[model samples]
Target chain A: MNLLPTEEQQQIVDMVRGFLAASAPLERLRPDKFGQIGNPDAALWPKMAELGILGLGVPEEGGGLGLSAVEEALTYIEFGRALVSVGVLGATLGAHLAARTMPDIAAAIMAGTSAVGLATPRGAVAGDDGIFSGEFHLIEANEADFIVLLTSDAIALFRREEFTGQSERLSMDSHMRLMRAALESGKPLSWSSVKDGIDHARANLLIAAYATGVAEAALAGAVDYAKVREQFGKPIGSFQAIKHKCADMAIAAEVASCQVSFASVILSKNSDESRFHALASRIVAVDAALKNGATGIQVHGAIGFTAEVEAHLFVKRAHLIDFIGGDQRVQKGQFIGADAVI
Target chain B: MNLDYTAEDEIFRAEAREWLDANIPREVRPPDGPGMREFDLGWQRKQFEGGWAGVSWPVEYGGRGLSLTHQLIWYEEYAKAGGPNAELLFVGCNHAAPTIMARGTEKQKSYHLPKILSGEVAWCQGFSEPNNGSDLGGLKCRAEIVGDELVVNGSKIWTSSAHLADWQELLVRTDPAAPKHKGISWLICDMQTPGIELRPILIMTAPGHHHFNQVFYTDVRIPLSNVVGEVNDGWNVAMSTLGFERGTAGMLENIRYGAVVERLVDMARQRLGASALENDDIGQRLAQLRAEVTAVRAMTYRIASRAAIAPPGSEASLARAFFSQLQQRIRRIALDIIGPDSIELPEDDPWIRPYLRTYSNTIAAGTSEIQRNIIGERVLGLPR
Candidate 1:
């Protein structure tokens, strides 16, 4: 019944935290004057691969780390805190799904030579003729070497060249450029007969992990600001108003972190309760992230409302993550239907 | 991250389940009053006789002295079997004895621990006073040392079960000239002492549930040996007592809340029929609450697992605050699901009493407000 992370897990967290603190400080997440993101000056892809993050969930036989989902969740939390772009995780997921059938693509993904974009499952339709046609909403579409199309019944992979029309739209997150693809005819070279159950679980778990990261980041922003920002005679944090808000943010982040970690552990074990936990984790993480983001902005006062502050950045990224895996209402409904138990 | 019970834990759980199944009454125990008290004591005695009491207490103290994992398993199985409320014996069995065991003299341990575990005596805590509820350090309850005895003069309020208790784990100001937090002393007060008065406070949450008492001590005298710790170090002693209370009691409360939630869901289904969860809003809220409960369970487990690795501190307060508020939310949802029955005549609806009483969950022990302050100042390192 021990739920405490082993010494190794704590080391992993500290290692990632140390790297992120140095390489991608909170200052880098601040939005620029043009509302563009001012991310760190680092080539993150190869650096992340060098850290074994890109190959975290892939099996060793597939030329990857073969780490458990729990380990992947730990790294994803750091990704959320650093506000790293979603392309890396999308690529990891794509590689994990393609590992058995498309080892070459998996290896390419692990080596950081290929990028994968994940399309929203709403518009895409899979046909029996090994073709998928729909206007797909994609994350990191422009930079993706391959795009993974998700549907209720199956998962299919499509190369960037297969799509005919693509239009990019800006997202709430400064770093994101959301794209919509008008697919003429996409060849599904190899479709995995993945059940909607597993996809729903996977999607929610991944999104929850990212959302927890965002919540942690927002809380950190508020706490850091509260300590140094003075109003009247004392630090604003001395005021119960700010103190209580920060406390609530801490609670939210803590609960979300626990929920996400619990779900990831369940997923790693392939437990019967995995689906329930995943959906529950997503609901909790989404709410926590959004709430923490809003509270972070409030704690920062006027500066937080401006795009220049990191508060809004966490808030915006939280919304993006929440939107990706169905909203809370949808996830809650699924959770109830699943009759999740502890 | 493995939550699976070890084989030994599983066996212990099964044995606990069997014992509770065979002993727990089929009917729900009376909510409060003499019948409820008897039920609680009887259950405690049964558990003691069955060698199931004081699970995590040291072996030298007449307890099973098992692992914390075993204690958690006992709580889970006990809650699942719908064990009677621990109110009647709570202070003695859970709080006082543990504090005594940790800091009391060998004589005190030998005197109190066995009687407590055997349910031969009931105890109440005398920490919160009328004027010093949240500001406990400012309590005016005074005790003056007179030779080998201590003369006490004070009033304590919200002392639950004090009227029925045989003894009390008391805190009093012993040195008025010292700082507020440093002047206090922790003592074991015999409830039968002369010059003591008990006035039960009538509560609105449930009928006949008058467990709370306003106890006044005009000039109660106690032997100096009754002091649990050093004269002026009672603040730390009391805090340690609260720590133990929060850890075991909080974990047990989470498990109990889980069972209560299951019943609430069952009632919801029975009342609303097949379409109960059809309403999207209700469904979403129920599911959200369910998730929150599970998260709390995990949080509790995490805290338990961490307690072994880390030194105890204000971390337990985090779980205490979170679970207390979660209990409130769960009952509110339950009442909402119960609808008009919540306000009906007789007010005997099971959900109504618990829903209203949920107010105490946040207020007692430490207010949710105070808990937030602790988390902010102590846990998160925010400014005081």
Candidate 2:
């Protein structure tokens, strides 16, 4: 079995990496520069659409590039590395999923004229009038032109104007814009019936990809710091303690990346073990990101703890990403039940 | 990339599964001792007779000359079939023969390759010295040329199967005045050479485990032609041996871990009942373990895929470190589910010994610390 990516896949990764490195750098992602970071970078959105990232997951007929899940995953890895707000993921997923069922929303997402956010079912509820009520923990909802409510059994879309009460909140990751909102009146743009918790399973797979990206970035930062940071008249990396930690972070990042890629493949294939593999990928990705993030900070010494450094940003992103698409415990329980082999 | 086996690989796998199923001893074999040695030898002989030995070796060398992927398939099938451990023949067939094939003289290759493939001569490595555990380059075992032969002295420790080996792939200091790494030479030493002695180190976990030993070479002499590579250049040859040592074995190890985990799952089901599922924490941990196992296997395949294009060096260190830690994690999870009862298992309980021995996985081959250093310096290009 050949598990390494093909040349084309690698080129896609390289292109995305280059694009993000040049256009959507972490410095641009800082909220201090932008007024309220929850809002999608107005200039970056059109560039993403121009680069075909927004249309990546959408079907060709919907004016999209019609790439596969693996491509989508690769794109998200770059997004995570750049600390792109979850609004991008939310909008892309919403547009892609709505291509056939909700054409208007798909067109808006593809044209970069609208943003979409997703909320889990935990604090969200639908009233008699089909209005979304209750305090919905929305991911980048303030910036979203529409919101997709994902429940255990169904996925429904709603316009942002339907919400009556909304309050913005700070998430662990400064790049994310969390919102608590009450919808007075809402209408479903479209609803897709999910099977056997497949929606969350799939989301977990993408989240895992993002988490792997966070991990790789964190590890690279640490290794870079270890090489240049001097201690006792030598680069800290020359010391076994720091060197091994960097080695461990590298291993974790590589494994996490592999797992995410593998899971994306299985999910695309719609394999019998897709859900289990996806959940497992999420678990590994979460653990690796958190561990590597902490280690990256420690390797950076006191500078890592300061808000100015990128090390702390990754750690915060890892924490927030862990809770997305079902937390570690939730995914684990579902995974074990889904595939009963072990 | 594709994870599906090719038609050829599948056929090979099926053939291997059939051969192993028909031949592997059904009863659980003793872990170690004289009986275990014989058992390992017998298994190797059986594999040779079945035309399955040295599948990765060239056909002219009395091997099947299959691709590395085929070797992986065979290892997976062997582990799945619960094949007996080949501990006694590992150094000969896996490390020594491969190194010999790469660097040995035609005569050395013709002689040692057949014997190793046929399981006629078991081999042990003589690399580590008591003072040079992870610092392998600093080993002080000396061999001075005297006329047409070399007089060898000094000792090698933690040489597994040394007491039972008929030959040894020994690394000795040929020019001590030169740089430490540059002075070494790789030699094929006959275990019965004059003044050669073995003192088995009894492991506390397994009684009569003669697999690990310390070998002393006092005034031992061997012909200069016995050197596998040029004198004083054995460092590169020995590195080649270690690269093989770290890489291939992980495939079978991953499959073995899979089998053990399957059993562990069954055990968890029996002991924890509905709670195994009801307890989200325990259930998730189990799921995570299973996922991690698959990840390690994927990592192995990715690493193995590079064999044709690149010679494995510090790259193998990544797999080595990951697998060692995964082994420990699998055992820890198993014990977590077994809990207090695990401590009170019968003296010969199947799980107890391996769980106890799991600590050695990271320590042996190279400590996790050493592996990380190699990875950081060689793979990551960090300063030494």
List candidate 1 stretches off by more than 4 Å. A32-42, A121-136, A149-157, A160-165, A182-199, B206-208, B266-279, B345-348
Backbone clash pairs for candidate 2 read: none
- Estimate how well candidate 2 is docked, as a DockQ score: 0.57
Give the TM-score of each candidate: 0.94, 0.93
What's the CA error at residue B158 for candidate 2, in Å? 1.0
Return the lDDT, model 2, position B134: 90
Residue B180 of model 2 has an lDDT of: 88
Which pairs of residues collide in model 1? none
- The alpha-carbon deviation from the true structure for residue A52 of candidate 1, after best TM-score superposition, in angstroms, is 1.9
- Model 1 chain B lowest lDDT segment of ten: B273-282
What are the per-residue Cα lDDT tens digits for candidate 1 across A11-81? 88888888878877767655553337422422677777788778887778877888777887888888888
